[model samples]
Target: MKGVEIRLQVQYRARVDESIEACHARFTAGMQQFGPPFGWQDLEPPPAPYIKPASGDMIGVEWFRYPIKGLKLQITAQHRHELSIGTDKDTSDDRLSIEFKTSNKALDYRAILREHFPKLIEAYRGYRAWAVFDYYGGRYTDWNWGPWLGREATNPSYQRLCKEPGVDIDGRNNIFTLEPAVFWDNELCRRALGYGPEEVMRRLQGHALSVQPLLDGVYVVFDDDPALTYERFLEINKQFKELLGIA
Candidate 1:
């Protein structure tokens, strides 16, 4: 289904301890303007080992699943001490708030919001948070997009390369270039491949073809592997590459 991605950056002057609660109140109030039976539920905290810091830091995130519209919303508030407080020792705080919304009837939703939540719309205009909501009316598939065994550093560098294209040898703006090309001194490759300098040198000495790291944690094999065999790697890589390319 068609949808719109709405991003709002919000700024607030408040105390660090109160920022979270204040944000919650603002969001709840905004949601209330949308009317009842909207069905809001908090998403589980990012699965364990990936849990974000809960300390008094910048950007407190709250995720919600909107049952009525089947939309996902992320509310993020970032504490800005420098801007809010004149000096480092000062306790005053400011927050950058962001919200994202996606929905099938985007125009209608926007009109409804503008008419019912004028303050929220106004807040969105000057807010400084990194919030965005993407509503899609389509099925989502599960696909792994993380580093694989022996390729820890690969994904990060690939992401960087994708972001800034000069580092790519093929000039394709794609990290896959690094896959066939030798790792050289790229740190991401080292992390993803999970090999130290010495180990990388040793492996390259014997292998004719090596795995190419791609964005979203997939790899490509350009050369044939006889000893360890690249088939398994190629198979898994192809699967993810296809999965990620799908809309």
Candidate 2:
């Protein structure tokens, strides 16, 4: 079966203690939601004797696996912080500040993200937590909000799509594209552009979707059908390997 793997990054900010507690709470809550009695395991520490460059600084790592809609979801959390006070005497205050980071491996399902994510977001909103969906495959592989939302005028065609009605372009849209390709007949592209088949193909071939690089690999988003999307993914994967000098 053809499928896509996703990697997500969730960051939560709050009083150091509160953030840590919130992370723990999330893990417990997620496990219960999945109806599994999963447990968190500590990741191996950095090579032993890891000398600390500073005092009152620490790091913690933990991993948990749970079932979500019949798919195994692996969630990892990392906490890093320092205990110190600001050097500025006026604004200086001694307090423990921490950063909470979490991520998950994709689950085997058409749509792993049910209403759970919205609930999770709401639960952590008090701590100013934000979840980012790093879509790997599908029609959104190559889409990126950074440059599109930025002031750059690189791809005029894509820019036009952003401006089109019924197409939400706001940062809050949360929609992204991976390594997407344009095919001769993509209904989504046709509808989004309000163009005929010939025009759609012309625009697509004339301007390919943008490419974005992830940690392990790169993806592109295109105005192509699902079958074509998979084909283009293979093509880009080959090109990426060649560029990396990988056999």
Candidate that would win on lDDT: 1
lDDT of all predictions: 0.33, 0.31
The TM-scores, one per candidate, come to 0.31, 0.32
Candidate 1 vs. true structure, TM-score? 0.31
In order, how many clashes per candidate? 33, 21
Q: Model 2: runs farther than 4 Å from truth?
A: 17-19, 30-59, 67-111, 120-247
lDDT of 2 by residue, 87-136 (tens): 21111111111112122223311122232332333322322111222233
**True lDDT of residue 120, candidate 2:** 35
Per-residue alpha-carbon lDDT of model 1 for 13-53, expressed as tens digits? 34434445554555555444444223223422221111145
Every candidate's CA RMSD: 17.9, 16.0
Looking at model 2, residue 38 earns an lDDT score of 21
